[model samples]
Target: MPIRLASRSLPLLLGLLLALPTSLHAQQPTAVIAAEASLESWYDPLEALGTLRADESVTLSATVTDTIAELNFHDGESVEAGQLLVRLSDNEAQADLRAAQALRDERRNTVNRLAQLQSRNLAPRGDLEDAQAQLRQAEAEIQALEARLSDYRIHAPFAGQVGFRDVSVGALVSPGTELVTLDKLDVMKLDFTLPELALGQLEPGLPLTATSAAYPDTRFEGEIDSIGTRVDPVTRSVTVRALLDNTEDRLRPGMLISVVVNRAPRQTLVIPEAALIPEGHRQFVLTLDPADEHRVTRREIRIGARREGEVEVLDGLNEGQLVVAHGTERVRDGQPTRLLGILDETTSVPELLRRGRDEAEASG
Candidate 1:
């Protein structure tokens, strides 16, 4: 009978030992990194590739064929509008101007003398009229010569920087020969294209940002100033133009850049992306009990758009509630938890873990 009692007691004692560990595990709180849901401005981003261009660009060239007489600018020199850049050979033209001026003076004297003589009846009316016509013709000739003289010179059309000089002094050049290039670099224009579906979200004065591989650490801010009226039928896309301030002259034409257009922006509740526990098609999060910080309850949440390190919580989560951001793998619904630290979009996970370890060592 004593032997029979010992066998029954052995099974009961084994059962108790197994139950003890299970109860202890349930009672012990799990350590986890948590993050608070908060409201922040969120933007839907539209990305595209863009090309940079100067606000105003032109290739300077001479309109008339002639030998270069003088060069007043160097390569990459800034000039003002109407500044004389090059003077072609005008020696022959100057001689003609002087002779025309002499003839004009002679005709004016004849006209004046004829008027006086006609008033005294010493000269016939026809003679006075003939001298007047001759005087007018001489003046017209001088004006025509002056206009032609302007063609032999080159002047800057606007205030900008000039490119390299392709020809030297005394080098004969013909019409359409490129002399230099001028560009107004105080402002830059960025052109990019987006699909036709994005047209409804684009308009003038919309703000944008751009980045370039040349300046890896820099970001350029601009706003939409123009939108194409027609969409490409083949590509189903529309062109957009933005204006960026280039006061530093860092941007240049034909540079490939990345563009981001901030479309719809609004304030929405957000949490660190790591806090979401995705199960198949649905999403869930572990939230701490307000009254009992060590107790956590698994919650099903609806989410919207996601940015960088955070996600927009559309439903099932309220602002200011804490959710598990780290160590979600070892946690379960209605599990007791110990708060390690609060995590945010800007927080580093490894750093947070180190801090938690240090705190644990201090407490022990």
Candidate 2:
């Protein structure tokens, strides 16, 4: 049970703290637990709404006007890089290629014949030049035909999940027509916005946790991948981007998620929250003087953040000094008190809080 300092304990504590003439202090020796203040590192984490985006996304389309000859992928199927996706009717391109090949063969023979005749001094230099120009022209035509054939076939640019398609075999598609969509979902880009005030803490590679209503029981882990170059003028918020692994392929693009960023922790002196005795707005704690355990003093303290049932002491205390965490109601300025056994140094913060709570409850 926590020790509750009440009017009854206060009188005894005041006498011990005040040193009340050696006679009075000796008369009322109030034993109290003294625990040393500890230095701990603490951090304040922030949460913001964010979105999931694919590592890569694209709406696949055709570059040439032609009839679709084949559709190689099914809706929602995974595909590999360079995998055939759609094949347009290549009759025209292939025919052009064959014709160019035949023309190139004919031109090559003509050039070889002209070269031999010139070597024999039977053909003029102009004849060989003309034949060579024709061979070059044929080669150029074959290249153009090959390029055109490529437009007739569509290959996956990267490995990804393919979305549904509206085009079917034998359907004619024009340039710029939408065929289907593909997304690289192995890793996702998570984007969120934070107020400009949080900009100071913004940095790359910080740890993050992401959760979504769609998957309430599960949490996804990630890290800040990048930050936006500028903040939104109207909203006064900066955009942050994070990278999350989706190897399990559970997280999808365009999903709404909640992101928690674990910022760097700062060091500070900390003590049990129960140690603070609040008198109106100001707070104070009772501590035994290091030089004399019999003398107790009231120390005013400024607090910062509170966590794990412990409060940060901004001032008026240093680490390793013993403080009266409980039975503070009885302690008064400059009182002399009997020493109780010190709290075990290994006792955890959670255990201390539980003990303090029980003591308060029992006293009530």
Candidate 3:
């Protein structure tokens, strides 16, 4: 009975021994995506959300207290510099102007009469001098009245689009009354803030690109017009202003925009975002030895900004090195690996899974 049991156990042991190599090979980390670290012209742009405003804006107001007699400008109309928009009642001012003009005319006649008498020596010199002084005084009064009358008409201070006015014809308005809004829309000003830690990168004339959700396809180009002199104590940030060309008048004032400033660029080592593996506070990645692609090992890398699906490798990595981008979880230090192909970060997961399946089928 003992000899019969040994024969049965031997066949089972041989069958289990044959399956060991297959199971071990299947468990090895399959590198379906191997990305090479290289020097990429990376953009380390600082980004922030900001508001867009007219390059020049103002609210037109009544300069003097008076009743609005006429509204010359329609709502939302383009106005040129010095174009009349509103007219205040000038009945009393006009009457005073007429009186001044009549007095001036009378004084001029008297002055002419006095000059004629003086030339002929028929009138006293003192009387002629008195008449001339009165004539000059009347002329000054006329000039003053004319200037006061001009104030009744309100003209556009600059070339811009005029907003609607709350007051209409016959409405009583006073100095500083809200009449309308004017905005120069040929160019736009964008104000944004960035952290104080980025002070070193702030400068005038930096190139910027701005976008808005209202016009997603449109990208407005601009540049840094100025930088704030002081940093905000509460936020530890500095304000920056950019000027964007709005000749088309597509950018509206008070609209929010996303800003990206082009910082000083340099070629640096970079890797795919998926290659980074966070282990506690440190990051880990699997790199293959050039001579032995199958010999994979874990390596730590210092990373900076992750933009456009690529990670900026600040340190702990070298250019032209190969790393496992996909199937990273299955990889460990001193593990077996198979280099499939160069897989970009944009590659879909289904494609990677299909590649892994094909490799597994071919190996089997």
Candidate 4:
């Protein structure tokens, strides 16, 4: 009888446990999740690498062979147009010019005397003509000598900053020898290469932006100046050039730069990056259905470009749908979910703190 009573009591206790109120059970609040639907108006950009170079660069050279007598300009000096840069030894040239002038004067006198004789019939016609020819030849010779004397001096062809001088004062320089380099850096060029697939997208005057590691925070703006006519066979890429304003002179030639090509504006569906779930070769997200009492459902979506903290959804999603941004792994498809609060309407803790500080200052 005692054993039967114990068995009955055990069955009764188990029944009581099963019949207990749900409130009496160990109950915890369901996990709260956040979500946002994909929306349009996401900006996608193409990035490339490039180098900055001076827009105009040239090597200054001697046009005539001569001894450098005086170097009027120093290395790395800013010179104005037509400024005298160097002077060669001009003693021999000056003497030659003087001799030519004297011969020209002598010929002039002979020609005048012959003309007088011809008028009086005291000289032959051929003699008078010969004197006239000699005067003409002498005049031509003087002009040629004067031109040669002008080559003894060198002047700046354009207004620009000069580079290091290769020849010094009293240094003999031959024709075509490099003296210095000149460059105009007020505006610069950014040269970069793009893949062959991007060739169709390139066009003149397209807006471009670039930044250098030296100045990471500052962005330089420019536009496509030109595109190469042929693609490089080895790299299968085409060269592109952009013109950037360097009025501040902060950017220098040969500086490595990162380029961003601003393609056509596009409107694409975008969602918070946190909502995406990657699994092998597929990506998915959890969405809430309001009509079905906020039931969570999993959805596969095609992702496009990502910028900032948002990602563009190319397909498999639409606007006005709620996606799970947090606590996604805990939920299942078609499962009933009780929203603790509207996740999309919530702001970050840092943002809230900043706003509170701003409000306090305003009130004070």
Candidate 5:
């Protein structure tokens, strides 16, 4: 009888031990970082990979085949519009131009003499008319020669930086031979592609931000300059072009960039992402009871767009309500809690705990 009684009491003892921990845990307040759900502007982001390009870019080449006579620009030199960059051998063209000028002068003298003689009835009207025609032809010939001479020279079409010079003085070059590259760098054009599904939201003037691996810490800001006229049938995407100010000249052509386009802003309840508790497909958070600040209630919530360290709470939460941002694993529904410092984007769980310990010692 004594052995049987001991066995029954052993089970009771185990049960009591388990019950004691629950009672103690319920009374002991758990310390956790808390945050308030507040109303803030929220944006939906569309992301894509982009390629950077100069606002204006072109490859300079010779218009006619000739030998390079003069190189006025060095590699990577900045030049202004209409500035002479190269002068090919134009000796033959110059000679022709001089001859045309002399012929024009002679024709002009002949026309004047004939006009004077015709006015006094000493020359025929046909002779004066013929001289006038010859003078006009000579002038036209001079214009044609000047135009041909222009083909032997190269000028900067716009103000920009020039790339490497491909030829040197006395080097033979032909038509379509690349002389250099010119790019306007004061503004940058970012071209990216987005899916056709995003076409409705895409338009000119939409704000965006971009980042490059080369400059990881820098964020480039710009606005949409235009949208593509047609969607690409193969990719089911449309091209987007944005203009970013490059006054500092930090951006370059062909740099790979990651882009984020922000949609219209709307007011929504936002909370630190640390406060969320994920269970399968649903989400939950521990909220402090209004009547009992120490007590917590596990509430289910729906979430929307998330960015950085914060998340948008779509349902089951109200603005200005307090939720446990940290130590959710240590607390249970209806369990008592001790408030620590509120968690923010810049604050960490360990930092908040350190502050709590300091405050407790001060108060004691």
Candidate 6:
């Protein structure tokens, strides 16, 4: 009986030992992460989705009705201005030109003969005038035929890269038929739309920056070339165009890109997103006192636009003030916090907040 009683007590003792540590740990305070503030320039960039397009684009088409005799340019070939791209059946044009020349030659011979006769007083004045008129008419006909012959050969209108050829050799095409597409891509155009509120800030020649998903690390700079005079009633946005040098031709048309337009520069404060704590509809953060390294105070911040893991604090924060970065949720107002190593604390809050607010207001 004594052995059985001891076994039952042993099981109960083990259970109590397991539960005690959990309860004790639950009651203990958790370590909170903290950050120190420093003054540095911060940018609250306005971001928008855009597409890359060629500065000059056109579709090549035939100017006259004819059957294609030869296709000079291959698909996706770079061509120069005035380069021959297509050849049409010129046999008929050549024959017509020859006929016109023959008629002109006969008329010229008659005019010469009549002029000599009139000089000798052997021909009537009316006859000489008729011969001269006939010569002039023949010359005009020849010039017209020559112009028609020139149309049989199609030339490039501008220096650009050619797209796929639409017509093949021996294909019959008319004036309106598409032959190929030509695009000048040495310079590219980036087009994006901005909110109507930004219309006041937007102007031609404003500096802008852009990035593409294909080359995210690389940044391209440009300036606003034009702004839409009228805003779209449905979207309430205005179109903006920026011209960028794409000499390398790395950027292609229709590629999606992100645009950032800098309107003006001002000073503001900025912070990281991890430092913010949201309670209900309001936002707050844990701020540390410079005098006391451990004492933290809950600061209610008027937040603005957020991007790239960072947040802009419009109010309730100041430059050079330490703010808790990590472990914000565990921190309470006036709680003592352990200062971990400051991670990227070198940023101004005021300038960041102002820029963020401007962008948000523009978007709204």
TM-score of 2: 0.71
TM-scores of the models, in the order given: 0.84, 0.71, 0.64, 0.66, 0.81, 0.64
Q: By TM-score, who's the top model here? A: 1
Instruction: Sort every candidate by lDDT, greatest first.
Output: 5, 1, 2, 3, 6, 4
Compared with the true structure, what per-residue lDDT tens digits does model 5 show for residues 229-266? 99999999999999999998888999999999987758
Q: Is candidate 1 or candidate 5 better by TM-score?
A: 1
**Candidate 6 Cα lDDT to native:** 0.81
- Runs of candidate 3 exceeding 4 Å displacement: 1-42, 124-129, 265-306, 310-364
Task: For model 2, give the 10-residue run with minimal summed lDDT.
Answer: 24-33
Q: For model 5, what is the C-alpha lDDT against the true structure?
A: 0.91
lDDT of 1: 0.90
Q: Could you tell me how far off, in angstroms, the CA of residue 306 lies in candidate 3 after the best superposition?
A: 4.8
Q: Comparing 1 and 3 by TM-score, which wins?
A: 1
lDDT (0-100) at residue 343 of candidate 1? 75
**In candidate 4, which residue ranges exceed 4 Å CA deviation?**
1-44, 115-125, 265-304, 310-349, 353-364
Which run of 10 residues does model 5 get worst, by summed lDDT?
1-10
Candidate 5, TM-score vs. the true structure?
0.81
Q: Is candidate 2 or candidate 6 better by TM-score?
A: 2
Q: How many clashes does each candidate structure show, in the order listed? A: 0, 9, 0, 2, 0, 10
Q: Per-residue error at 75 for model 6, in Å?
A: 1.9
RMSD to truth, every model: 3.7, 9.2, 6.0, 7.1, 5.1, 12.0
Model 2 stretches astray by more than 4 angstroms: 1-41, 267-277, 281-302, 307-310, 313-364
* Residues forming the 10-long window of minimal summed lDDT in candidate 6: 35-44
Can you give the lDDT of residue 124 in candidate 3? Answer: 90
lDDT of 1 by residue, 1-364 (tens): 3545567699898899999999977574778888889999887999999999989999988877889999999988999999999999988888999999999899899989989999999999999999889989998999999998998988999999998888899999888999889999999999999999998888898888899999989999999999999999999999999999998888989999999998886899999889889999899998988588657888999999998889999999988999989888988888778777787657777878888889879987
